[model samples]
Target chain A: MALKFKTPMLDELEKGPWPSFVTDVKRMAARKPACEDWLGLMEMSYEHKEGHWKHGGIVGVFGYGGGVIGRYCDRPDLFPNVAHFHTMRVNQPASKFYNTDVLRKLCDMWDRRGSGLTNMHGSTGDIILLGTTTDQLEPVFYELTHDFGMDLGGSGSNLRTPEGCVGMARCEWSCIDTQALIYDLTMEYQDALHRPMFPYKFKFKASGCACDCVAAIARADCSIIGTWRDNIRIDQEAVRAYANGELVPQAGAHGSEKYKLDIKAEVVDLCPTRCMEWDGKNLKIWDEDCTRCMHCIRVMPRALRPGLDTGATILVGAKAPILEGAQLSSVVIPFMKMEPPYEEFKGFVEKMWDLWMEEGKNRERLGELIQRMGLREFLKACELTPDPRMVNTPRFNPYIFYDPAEVPGGWERDLKDFRSRHQA
Target chain B: MSEEAKARIIEWVKQQKKTKHYFNDLCKAVPEIKMMQAKKIINELVNEGRLKYWSSGSTTMYMLPGQDDVAKEEKGMN
Candidate 1:
C-alpha cells in the first residue's frame, strides 16, 4: 500500500517531550507500509471543520481489561484496525514476580480479540490493552474481574491503586514490609477503588522508610512510611574496624567517615540514653535509648543496626487542588501498626475519605480542603485526635506581627528594599 | 493594474477603513484566503496609495490613507 501521511493539528505541547502518540504512529508507518492508511485518516481529521474522531463510539480490548484507554475511529471503512487503546499500570510486587502463564493468557486474549500492539504498562499505572469495540468493554471487564481475578483502578474521583516500594523481602534499607501493606490496603478498600464518591481523585502510597523509593511524599494523599521506636545498636569494635579500613563501608567512603565520627562523637555526645559509651578501648550501646533514625545504622552498617520493632508513620493531605497545581502529602498519623488485613490503617483511610468527600468543594484535593478549612476542623470531623508529629509547619508562615515602627526608616523603605531585592 | 486587482484593493481598503482589524483578523474573516495572500493584498493597497498600515508586534492593522478626519468626526458624534 502507498504511504498515506496524516497532518496533525499543530497545537501547544500538552505534555512534556518523550515522543507522543503522533511520533509512535509515524514509527509504525515506517515498519509496516499498510499502517500508512491509519496515518492518512489522522491527517484528514485535522483538515475537517469539526473534530477528528466522532464522539460516542465503542473501542477497547476483550471483555474486562482496564489500565488501557480506547478510542474508536469515526470512519472505520477508510482505515480498518485503527482503534485507540492505552495500558494499565499495576504496582509491581516487591519480589517482581509475575505468573508467566497469566501474562501469556492476557497477551493471547489481546491477539485474538483486539490489536497485537501491547504496552507493558499504561500511564495511570495499569497493564494496558489497546483497541476494542464498545461491545467488548463489559465482557472484557467481566473476564478481567472474574476470570483473571483482577480489578479496575481509578475511573473517576475515587481511590487510585495503592503503590509500594520493595520492602524487607529484597531491600536492606526497608525497615518494614511495604508489599504486605499495599496488598492489604487494596484488598480492604476494594469498594472505594471501584466506586466514585469524592469531589476529586485520591491516591495512596506506602514506603518502607523515609528512603521513599515509591515517591509517596509527592504522589499519595495518605502516605505510610516505615519507622522504629527503638535506638541504634552500636558496636565499638566494628566501628574501629570500619575506621581502620578493616571493614569496607556499605555506602562507601562517606559512610566509612560517618561511622568513624559516630564512634568518636555523636555516639558519645548525642546518644540521649547513654547507650553508647567509650570504655578507653571500645564503644558500647545500652540498647534502650537507641531510637532507630537509621543515622547510625546507615553510617556503620556492620557495626550498628536497627532493632526488630517496626511500624508505619501515616501522613495526610499531600496533594494540591486542581486549580493550584501540586502539593506534598503531610504526616497525619505519625505511627501505626501495619499487620496483615490492616484494620487500623483501613479505618484511618475510611475516616479521611469520608471527611474529604463530605467537606471538600468541587475540584479541591484533600490537601487543599485541609488548607482552606484548617487541619483542626478536618481532624475534628474525622474524629481523629491531634497528633503533633503529623502537623506540618507551613514553610511560608505569614503570621508575623508587623510593628510599623520597628523599621530603621519606615514601612515604605522596607517595602522598597524588598521590591528591589526581588525585582528580576 | 488589472480590473480584478483594483477591485481586490478597493475591497481591502473598505475592510481596513472599518476600524479594529489586523492582517490575521482579515485572514480569519475570509477563511478561504491564506495569511500570505491577505498580506500581499494589504501591501498592494498601501503601494497604490489606497490604504495606510501600522503594526503592534506581529499584528499589522490597516486604515484608509487619510481617515484621521473621519475618525475625529466619529469621535465628535459619539
Candidate 2:
C-alpha cells in the first residue's frame, strides 16, 4: 500500500534537497485511513494554493471557545473518512518539560479515542491531538483534565498558549523569571483562553534577554524580553586578562572553547551608540546613550554582565501579513520591573484587548489594528505615553509633529516630558 | 441493520411521548439495540421531523417538539 497511494503535489517536495513532511504523512497513509484523507486534503490544498481550513467553527470542549480547529475536506464526499476529523489542542507543561510517564499516558489515551495521530506540540506551544469526531470532544477533554491532570489551552480569537523560554531554570543570563510570568499570565487569563470574545488571536512569547531565542519580537503580538537600564557590570580585571590573551588554551583542554581576545578594532569602534571609550588602560561606557542592542555583550560575555536595574521591555506590532508585510515588534515600553501579580502588565494587556475588540475588523490582529489606525491613536486610546526607549532610531516617534516656531522650547519640552515620564 | 430493531426503537421513543433523551442515553436504556442501527433510525426520524435534535455542548439530544413544553408547568422557569 506504500506505493498504492498517489500524490503529485507532495512529490514536488521530494525533488528538492531539503527533507519534507510529506514523506512522514505518506508512511502513516499506508495503514491509517485518516492519513490517506489527510494526504488527499493536502494535495487538494496545494493545488488550490491557499489553505481550505477556514479556522472558526463551533467545536471544542464545553465552555471553551478556542483551541479545536474543525477541518473538513473541501470536497467532503470524495474524502468521507475525514469529514469530522477535528483537531484538539492541549495546554503544554511549562518550559515544555514533561515526564516520560505522562507522555505515555497521553499517547495511550489518544490511541484509544482519537485517530491515533498527534503533533507532539503545535507551533503555538500546545499539544495538538489531531482527528476526532464531535462525540470524542468532551470525553477527550475529560481524559486530559480529569485523568491526566491537565487543562485545555487557548483557542479561537482569544489569548493563545503563552510560550516561555527555559529561563532561570537553565540559563544564567536570563533577565527575568520567564516561566513564572508565563504561568501566572496563563492562570490569570484562563477565561480569555476559553472564551472566544476577541476580534482575533493574540499571542504572548517571552525571551530571557535581547537574544530573543524564541523570536518573540517577530512572532508574538505582545513581546516581552528581559533587559537592564543601568550600566553593564564589567570585570575590568577579566577584560585585561582576555586582552593580554591569557585565557587562550589548546582545543581539548578541559572541554572549554579556546578564548582569544584581540582588542584592536572590535568593541569600541563598532559600538552602535559610540558610548564606549577605551583609553590605553581603561574601559568605560556611558549607559545613558545605550539602546541595549546586545552586540557588545555577545562580544565580551566573560567581562560584562547584565546590570541590576532589571525589567522587561514590551514591544507591539509583531505579526504576519494580512494587509501588509510581516513585521518585527516595535519597542513600546522601555523598562518594566519583573514582579509577581503583574498588575500593571496585565492591565496594559487588557487595555490593548479592549481597543482591538472595538476597532478591529474580522480576523484582524492587534498589529493590523495598529497599522490601520496609526500608532498614536492606539497609544492615545490605551492611555500610555510615548517614551524615547520606544524609538528604534532617531526621529522615530510618530507623534512628534514639529512646528518650526514652537519647536525649540515648547514642543521639545512637551515631547521630552512625555518620554521621561513613561521611561521613569 | 434489523428493520424490526429500527421500528421497535422508534416505537419505544414515541412511547416516551413527553421525555427528551440524548442519543447515547436513549440507546443505553434499550438492552437489545445496536448503536449503528439506532443512529441511522434516529437520523431518519429527525429528518422527517417525527424526532427533533438540539445540542447541549457536545451531546445531541432528541425529542418531539409537541412534548417539548413539559416545562410549561414551571411558570417560573428562566
DockQ of each: 0.01, 0.02
CA displacement after TM-score superposition, residue A115 of candidate 2 (Å): 3.2
Clashing pairs in 2: A66-A155, A66-A156, A67-A155
User: What tens-digit string does per-residue lDDT give for candidate 1 at A1-424?
Assistant: 2356535452222247765775564555664433455566656766676544532211222221122333445565676545332233333433244699878877776655545445665433446565554455566566666877766555334566777877877777676788777777777766555433455567788888776777777877788888766655557688787666576565674543333343556446655445567655677676644434455566567787665576887777676445666888776666677887788877777677767655666557788888888777777777776654553443345354344564476564467778887974
- Chain B TM-score for all candidates, comma-separated: 0.53, 0.58
User: Candidate 2: where is the Cα deviation over 4 Å?
Assistant: A1-4, A7-20, A40-56, A244-259, A279-281, A395-399, A402-424, B1-78
Poorly placed runs, candidate 1 (over 4 Å): A1-80, A83-96, A122-124, A246-300, A391-424, B1-78
lDDT of 1 by residue, B1-78 (tens): 334554664575575546534433444444555433444554555556665442221122445644544334323423
- In model 2, what lDDT does residue B37 have? 49
Q: Pick the candidate with the highest TM-score.
A: 2
